[model samples]
Target chain A: MFLTVLSILGACLLIAQTTVLARMPPWLGNPDLLFLLVLFVAVKVDTFRGIILVMIYGLMMDIFSGFVPGLYPAVYLGLFLTIRYASRHVIVDEPVHLPPLAAASYLFCSGAIFLYMTIFNPGTDILWSWRDLLLQMFILAILALPSFHVLGRIAARIASNRRRIFSTAKGGNRFIS
Target chain B: MRKRSKRTRPIRQFLVISTCIVLFGVLALSFMGRKELTLPHRLIFDILGTAQSGVTGIINYVLDIRNDYIDLIGVKKENARLREEIKRHQALTVDYREALATNVRLRKLLDFKEQIPQPTITARIIGRDPSEWFKTFSIDRSSSDGVGKGMPVVTVEGVVGQILDGGNHRAKVLQAIDPNSAIEVLIQDTRTQGIIKGTGDSYRLHYVLRNNEINPGDLLITSGLGGVFPKGLPVGRVSSVVSKRRGMFLDIEVEPMVDFSKLENVIVIMKSNQLTE
Candidate 1:
């Protein structure tokens, strides 16, 4: 049930990203809501559930963004696993770490994509603009904490609803018990 | 803790190994340039495309109302200016019609065969690529509308792009400004042939010899060498030309005729036989 809710949320984000956010001027910098969602899942959701959600988000991105089929999934999954491993050792779940963590992860994904394109698809030229990269990082940093907070609340709400449903199914009292 | 870790180690190992294998396989497929859409992808695209179309429509409608209200602010002065412009255009239209009639008569006198007009379908832009690196967009037309991969999409101004793929009721367009896009074109005045490659924001004319006499503002039209795009369509205009002392070719930049960012409607030229190479 949580997975379903999160998937719908991801789909809505993807839709907005491709439509409304895409229409924004490049200088304004569009926030990557899906990437932030991946980060949220990595920190809050369990490993198996988080991996599934990440893959779904990655596949949605792949379908919309690039001609390459598996690039986003690979990048996203790699990031999810790395963050999962890192969080096990470090206290990265706190809101204080979001800005830098989001920025670093964005850089890592961008670098991996650049490397992949350079090595595999050499015929195409990819202009590396530091200004654009910095702007995206800045936007991601600004949006990271708030986006995570909202996603966390949504997850909590869904989990609570599931618990209530399960309780009601077990013949628990509706209001008092 | 050691015992628990020992029990789960094999499972973790298996998961990691399987992930690596799947990643490798997927990367291999991407490297191979797999363009075909599977059944599931098509279904998802249809659903998402419909949603995008609905959202775009609502946004456009709201924008139209806002623009209408804004336009009302200076209606009197704008009306006067447009009235004068209309009068000037009316006179020009007469001269243009006379020229067109004479050209038609000359063609008939010279036994010129009339070219069959290609069937075209108009598509509305539903969504755009979210990535900065790629210049692609989704349109409302699809394979159901006779829009196939490689079909040239154009606007009233000039060439927009080519169809990348067609879902059930929607299709993706690869804009001419994408780095991967290449079109065969020739300068209108000098007839110098070159390949136009996209440079993200603009185009770069390639393979024109250093000796070629090309200038900024020279028009470029498709040479029809590639079966994808039809001949004589306006592609872009030369923006700059530079001659390097070492290279065999001149570095020429082109400004695309179509402003991709402002595009909302496009026409897809349907060529039944030339859908794919």
Candidate 2:
């Protein structure tokens, strides 16, 4: 049930990203809300489910971005796996850990795209501006903590609800006993 | 425990191997150009694109409602003023009509069908390219309205861009100021020829001889050398020009006539036969 809700939410966010966010002022810069959601899924959800969700969202990103189809999937899935493996060794779910991870993931996704084009599609011209890059990173960093807090609260509620359902089912026979 | 572990191990291996194969397939498909979009690809675009169109419609409707309510405040005064202006313009239009009829007669004698620009279909911009470095956008015009790839899109002020990709109900346009865009142009005064390449918000006029009599505020128009854009269309105005003793060419920059940041409506030329030698 939760996964279904996430899927619907992901679809709505994807539509908003393509339509509404695309129209935002260029100087204000575009934020990757989907990436933040993926990060939340990575830290909170099961490994396999999170990886699959990230991959799907990444493909949806391609539709909005006008990029080639496979690039985001590969980058997003790679980030999910890396973050998931790192969680085993370190305390990755803490709020303090999310901003840097989100920033790094943004860089990794962008760098991989640049690297891919440089290596494979050299004929295409790519305009680069350091100012835009720095601005994007700064915006994402500022948004990270707030977005994480909001999503973390929602995830807590969902998890608690699931636990309550299971406990009630298991303890329902106490009156008969 | 041993039986369960054995069963799970092969399943995990199979899942991994299949996912790798699928990823490779997608990568290979990505390398293929946009022309190769298969049935499923088109279907996906059609479905998701409709959602984009719907969202844009809803937002535009709400904005329109707010604007209409605000506009109602001075409607009576504005209408009275416009009525007076229209009466004066209608009297002036009679003289303009006589001049226009004479101009058309003169053009017909000169075989003007090839000279006059053809009618165009207007398209509205619905979405922008999500990539920061790319200056492409999607338009509401589509193949059904005769919008085709490589067609020139323009505004009343100047050229806007060319269509890059088109679907039955939508099209993608690469803006004139994108780095990938290039046009053959000539300076109006001296007839100095150069290549106009997009450089972010402005344009760079390349290959101009260093000794040419170029200056700031010079007009650049499409030369129609490549048949991509019609001849004599306003491209940009020279914003700066620099020459060096060692180099054979001048470094020139141009300010595009159309303000892309404020672009809302554009007309796609249906057909243009105005080619020049």
Candidate 3:
């Protein structure tokens, strides 16, 4: 149920991103809500469920943007696994660490894509604008906390609802002594 | 560090093996270029494209209402200006009609062939590419509506793009401003041929020799050498011309005739043979 809800949410966010946010002024910079969702799943969800959700989001992104098929999935999964591994040793659960983490992850993914394109498709010209990159990084950092907060709340609600359903089922048991 | 249990070791191995397999699959797929849409990609397009179209419809409706309200604020001044502009255009139309008649007579005298109008379908812009790297957009029309891959999309202003891929009910357009896009164009006055390559927000006219007398504000029209776009369609106007000391070709920048960001509707010219793969 959590996966289902999150998937639907991700799809809706993608639609909005491509439709409405895409039409916004280029200078304002469209905030990557889906990237924030990926970060949330990486930090909050478990390995099995988180990886599945991340993969789904990445595939959805593949369908929407970029000519490369598997780039988003690889980048997303890499980020997820790295974060999962880093969280074990470091204190990253707090809100204070989210901005820098989001910023750094954004840079890593963008750099990875640039490297991939440069190596594989050298003929295609890719304009690397530092201004746009920094602006997007700043936007992601500012939006990271609130976007994660909302997703985290939704996840909590779903978990609590599952718990309540299980408790109610147990409470209503006629076979119990 | 604690030692792993015997049972957990196999599970860990399984996880590692699966991860490696997935990575390998991704690497293999990533290297491949754009191809026909798979079942999953098509399904996603059909589903998501419908939702995007519906949302865009609503947003456009609301925007229209907002624009109408805003227009009401300065109606009197705008109306007066429009009236004067219309009077001037009406006078210019007569001269244009006479010039057109003269051209027609000249064409008949020269035994010029009559150009048949290409079949076209209008498509509504549904969604745009989310990433800043690529300039692409999804349209409501698809293969069912005769919008096939490599169909040239245009507007009244000028050339828009070409159909990248088509699903059952939706297709994606690779905009002319995308880096991957290149169009064969000719300077209208000088007739010097060159390739116009997209540079994100604008186009760069490439391969024009330094000796070519290309100037800023010169119009560029499709040369029809590529067979993708029809001949004489307006592409852009040269915005700047710079002769660099290093290169043989003059650096030319162009401002596209079609405002891609403001485009809401486009016409796709259907061709029986797909010229581009």
Candidate 4:
């Protein structure tokens, strides 16, 4: 119960991050927190549960943010599944890897929409200037680093505290083994 | 009786499960498939409209209450704004009436089409495109309201521009100042034709031959050579005439009678004057 609560708390914090980023001045750029949340979940939870949580959060983000809907959901699911596979085969517990993963996921989400537009809505005038893309990348890099670091630390602390409390309260017999 | 109850258990469960399944199916299908495809989607639309109206009403009520409080506190800024808006609207109504009266008078005065035969649609300018070079503006009317790409838009006084791009209930009009804008204009008095081309900030009557004998104050209306704009609709007045002694063509600057900077309302010209009842 505590772990579930903590996971939800993490999700809410992610939402708050998105809201703050959105409210910031336009020069700051729109940094997506949905990726950070998915990455955190992938590291903290197992594959199946991670995917489910990320899917729900992705759907919520898609509904909240203004754009073609489902664009976030499909991209987030893919990100989660990849992270899960990486966690299974690799050491994702390290702190340094999370930021890069978050940044890459953010880029994927941003690029996916443009890719979809280019293919489906052909001949419709769309501008792809280099200056805009660079600005977006810089903003995403700045946002993803701090978010991943803080959220990763918070998730780790909560996980440890839950383990300690559960061990003490249940005499070490209540953990699902 | 015991055997009958045992047999009924699975059937009852099946009935309940089937009902739940159908409900979920309806909801999921409506949520996903119905939005982009066959379903009328009127429920979503109605809900949205109701929400918008609700918001507008709340805003109006709150603003009214706030203004009352502000008046009590000796801040009468809103009153000044209201008075300003009132004056502006008064000017607009007067101009509208005057233009309509002129159209009536002109139709009678001239032996041309006695009736204003073409149908018209009045749409509000809802948004401005961010691209400066495109010089595009969007209006509320769309294909559903008999509006299409290439339809000409104008104020009662003169031409505004042509609808360059369009969607279901939204469209972008390429303003007269756009580099790509072109129209066939005729001198209303002599009926001398010239190609009206945009010169960045305003349009100029181009390709007017040296011998056309054009002068300032010539009313250049749409020539109706292209089916897009109806002929005889006032475009602009010839502001300047450059008489080149040896040049092949003359440069005539037209002052667009419709002030694009202060465009408040516009009417879409639907078809030729002869076609409508």
TM per prediction: 0.71, 0.65, 0.72, 0.39
Better of 1 and 3 by lDDT: 3
Candidate 1: tens digits of C-alpha lDDT, residues A29-91: 877888888888888899999999999998998778867778888888989999999998999
Superposition error at A117 for model 2 (Å): 1.3
- The better candidate by lDDT, 2 or 4, is 2
Q: Any runs in candidate 1 off by more than 4 Å, and if so which? A: A125-127, A169-177, B1-116, B273-277
Candidate 4, residue A111: lDDT: 65
Query: In model 3 chain A, where is the ten-residue run with the lowest total lDDT?
Result: A166-175
Give the native contact fraction of candidate 4: 0.00
State each model's CA lDDT, in order.
Answer: 0.85, 0.79, 0.86, 0.67
Task: Give the runs in model 2 whose Cα sits over 4 Å from its true position.
Answer: A1-4, A18-25, A85-90, A154-171, A174-177, B1-116, B271-277
lDDT of 2 at B233: 84
TM-score of chain A of each: 0.92, 0.83, 0.92, 0.67
* Backbone clashes, candidate 1: 0
Candidate 1, B90: how far from true, in Å?
A: 30
Q: List the residue pairs that clash in candidate 4.
A: none
- Of models 2 and 4, which has the larger TM-score? 2
Please give the TM-score that candidate 4 achieves against the real structure: 0.39
The order by descending DockQ is 3, 1, 2, 4
**Cα lDDT, model 4, residue B189:** 90
Model no. 3, DockQ: 0.35
Interface RMSD, per-candidate values to 1 decimal: 1.5, 2.3, 1.4, 10.4
Residues B1-277, candidate 3, lDDT per residue (tens digit)? 2455866888999999999999999967875896777777899999999999999999999999999999999999999999999999999999999889766644542332233277666678998887767788999998777678888988767788899998898999989988889999999999999999888889999999999998889999999999899999899999999999998999999999988888877778888844322
